[model samples]
Target chain A: MLTAFFRWMRLVLPRGDAILLAIALIASFELIGALVLLLNSKVSPVDLQLARTFFLALTAFVYGIYRVNEFHPLAKPDYRRWLETTPWTWRNPLPGGPVLLVPQDVVVLALLMGLNRDFSFQTLYIPVAFLSFYLANLMAINWLLGEWQLAYSTGFGLGLGGLVFRRPDYLLLIDLACYLLTRIAVQRSFRNFPWDDSHQPCAPIEASKLKGDSANHRLGWPYDSLTPAKLRIGFRLHDAICFAVLLGWWHLTLLWGADERVRFLIIALPLIAYVGIPLLRVFPYFYMHRSPIDVWGRIANSWWVIPKFDCVWIAPLSALMLNFLLLGWASWYEWTVRFRYFEVTLPTDWRYAVSISLAPVGTTAVSLALFLIGPKLEHWRLTGQHRIVFQRSQEFTEL
Target chain B: MIQLQQVTQHYGVRPVLRRIDLTIETGELVAIIGPNGMGKSTLLAVMAGILSPQHGKVIIDGMERKSTVEHELAIRRRTVFLPDKPWLPKNRTGREFLMGVGRLYDIPDDGLIDHVERLLNVFELEKEGDWPIRSYSAGQQKKIALSSALVTRAPIMLLDEPFSGGLDPSGILALKHILKHQVQQERATIVMSTPVPELLEELANRIVVMRQGEVIAYDTPTGLRSLSQCTGPLDEVIARLVHPRTMENLEHYFQERPKC
Candidate 1:
């Protein structure tokens, strides 16, 4: 039945889109369920089962169709043409290349199977170990030459490895190996993933061609190739804005007499990335995107993966995580070490726009004024050559 | 001046253009007309420095014949090459798109808006100019593309199938008028490739005929029509020359095969 369902799916969605939609649906379900639990306090066993069945059913349908679409082979000439000039840059690798399924990353599915249970480090340890082991292995590979593909391979391999294992011991060894490897491996590939330089912004003509390829053979998703640098910058910007707003809220609380320790935690994390990371930069990198442990949920099937389940999730998640970590560190420092050093206040009315922030009624009117006048004051500054990269949609349209 | 000396281009094992020698002087209005798939677009791309020749050299304004990355970007900036279908920034309004382009080319402020407004009015797009190009019809999109190319006012212009889909009679006339004006005022050289021969009869100073990746003749439209001994009109002359009888004979063999 699953195979039959997959066969039909191949006809409708391309592999890249399929993977994207799968991540989206899974994340939506998780988020919706979480929202329900938050609002209702009691989500039934039947509700949980229904959600799991829906997720598995959707995955089966998507994966099956993607596999069927993968059958018809592309011409050698065309494939070679794609490889040499398909514009699969380090920034945004086209999803048309050969897809290597790292079976280890499938272990994350095990976590999904056990999602409703209490936190069992022992039960969860196998998948974590698998994730860490492969992540470590790739870190070692990355240290040798900062090979991004291998680094990703390690993460995917470990994650998938945990799922196939029935016993924790088998998972433990693989996880241990990956962990040790990550600890010993040099972390030179860690940096910002430049979103501007990504395939999103760089409109290379050939990129559009690869977008039409079959599912498994299609190039990896865009966020799959985001560099560490771009991710860091995105995170810092988002977190800084969120932290400022949080502070503003805390300050307002002071007027209302609810000022507390959480305010201090917000101000202390600046030293962590600037001082600690550099000092311990060589230490085993254990941050999200590279972290082996699961947070509240599996990132693969969480709200975190929504924007980029295809490619959107990575940018936002990376931004959110980086900010969260940095701000968390700052908050830690303020609470433990510098209680009397600063006074932060919350705004009388919240000005920051969180994912759920409400905007002022006249924001659009204000924006239009800025837009009209902004070009008048600005001289044509050459921000290098404005490059246009075509999306996959363009090739079909061009024809 | 754009010069192509013994240029060759291939699509895999099949050669699309043979050793072709051609030159367009500065400010010359050169039109390349041919049957389909005869490397007209390829030639334009090669001349625009978009495609490097498989063999031989393309010298632009006395430069040594080599295509460098900088030279390509420089050529693209200085010369506007409009593909058959123009690339429109769908999210941007026609006015915004033109303004952004004008700014990119270092056109002065205040003047940019006025210049774009004038062009928009002339193209009968005054009402739609303020709206995003996504709302534009096919004809409007073409006009926008042509308007973009015109606004750039680059020294060299390469247009491929510029008249394919769009253009009212008045719009066509306006475009011709603009092209002529650009040549006279800016001393801009224009190379346009179109399937339609009659369209260029009044405008083109020189029409180069291409067939099967080679330029069979390069002369004025009148001269080519007079010289060719082909049976039909200009399109037929192009068709016969591009697909010689030898290849068409293969069609008979395919047709004879039994149906499955």
Candidate 2:
């Protein structure tokens, strides 16, 4: 069974051992860092608890995503075809379709538990609830429908229940019940697998139901859902909305007489959500859509050109607008209201001075950086080759 | 003329087409007949610009494929390559898919609509045309894919196993009449690969027989029959030219079977 699992892993990961080694090295580094953090005496109990919960929840979320992707019926039709036609049968124990747990998962769990020995039973239940929920619906009739939501909700509910009840005994009972139910459902699903029924013709009535379901229809950004121009406009609109919300929250925090730290944190949310996330998503599109034909020469050039052009122009403008809004809102609030609820006062003058000086400068810096590195990054991504930074030593041969 | 000049292709280390050279003239119906795994599909793919050959070039109407994006696009506008297993987008209806293909080939909207309706009727797929391609059976999907190719009205049509994929007798007869009309009236050039050469013997102007990534023979049906000294069907001539021991192996296998 272990051999079969390894063989399956090898088949799935054809990029060879380099990727596996990279993953292992990264995991080891994270574990060592986590252990060092755990051993520190200055670390507060709240910080430790937060770290533990974040890592555990992150593990559960990553595992849930992996399982959903692995079990998605339409994700890899070629792989499924190969599996169905191949002579190899699942050698894992019955009732548990296939043992997809990798060595990294076990190592991560062990390291996490070892670092936090005094962890509550709820921390242990987090992974169990998530895994059970995924297993139950992994082979369900409508596995695609709300599978991620179910897994996440189960983990969240279990963790919350454990915290509220403050009773490990009841939490254990609930966990056991969930596990048993998952086991029975999985066993039945495996016994009568719906391989043939998977290809059932969807009824015409289902089409109407899916008319408004953008989640199901979203193939990818800027690929199937929207044209390049539309995607650019959509991103601009999204950034504008984020900017408005952030400014509103900042004003609210000011009105409530929050401290400097909270105010600064509130302002950072829009930067992360709008600028960072959009930049990350735009790279692939940039790489895919770069073209030799410019806008003037050809009416229909590469799809990436418009999006890239929009990013270069619109992103900086949006950032500047957000900064202006922030500065303007602070000025208005300072002029209109005087707060006596808290000791810390809003530094409206310094805020205005910093916003005015830094807004255009920061925007210009970001724009320049994007213009300079964006195309290079796109090229590097498309062509999987990179020039060596240092010259190789002639005498350095394989040992 | 569509010319493959010393074209060679390899999937990994295994060579599928080994320096194949062939010229297919305009309005010519060329049949690529061979045993399985003999690079017939690879040849068609190279010609269609779907797969780039490792060596040599594919030239269509004096424009070399892969020389420039504009050149490749020009060739694509004039050619329609139907792969053996056409991947139809599941969410789209058959009519929508055909129309999309027509639009891609820059067919006029009015002409495209009329052509799609005619194709659906001719292929007897009018009932299934409105449904999503996901709900289509293997045969219906093949018919729709064929309809898409026909809707293009391109001068060059490269079909890989058009008959073997799943077509009723009537659908096959309709396709035959359609291809014949396209070749004679529209002066369209066609290159199709098929395992069964009997179907193409009467229709194809020239037959190219391949064996293990190399062309063994390229001649007219009558020329091949005379060369092989076989008065039987084109399949028999193909077998004798490419796989002489196929009949012997079959006889041996049958003799080895236990008496019933």
For candidate 2, list the clashing residue pairs, or say none.
Answer: none
lDDT of 2 by residue, B1-260 (tens): 79989987655455678888899999999999898888898788678655556567889999987565456557767888777865556776788767766655667779988999999999998989999777887778788888888988989999989897668899889989999999999999999999987688668999999999999888899999998888997788888999888878999999999998
User: Highest lDDT: which candidate?
Assistant: 2
iRMSD for each candidate structure, in the order shown:
17.5, 17.9
Give DockQ per model, in order. 0.01, 0.02
Instruction: State the lDDT at B16 in candidate 1.
Output: 70
Tens-digit per-residue lDDT, A1-399, candidate 2:
998766655532324464475457546756765676779867676675656555655555555455545554334444444555554443434221243444555554555456544566756644553454455445333322323233333333333343324454465565555545444444443343324432332222222212222213311111121111111111123333333333343334332343445544433444444456335545444443332223442343223333423443354455445544543443333433346864544477666445434433333334333333333322222221111111123311111
Model 2: residues with Cα > 4 Å off, grouped in runs: A1-399, B247-260
lDDT of 1 by residue, A260-316 (tens): 343232233332332332223212111112211123323432424321112322223
In terms of lDDT, model 1 sits at 0.51
Which parts of model 1 have CA positions greater than 4 angstroms off? Answer: A1-390, A394-399, B64-66, B229-260
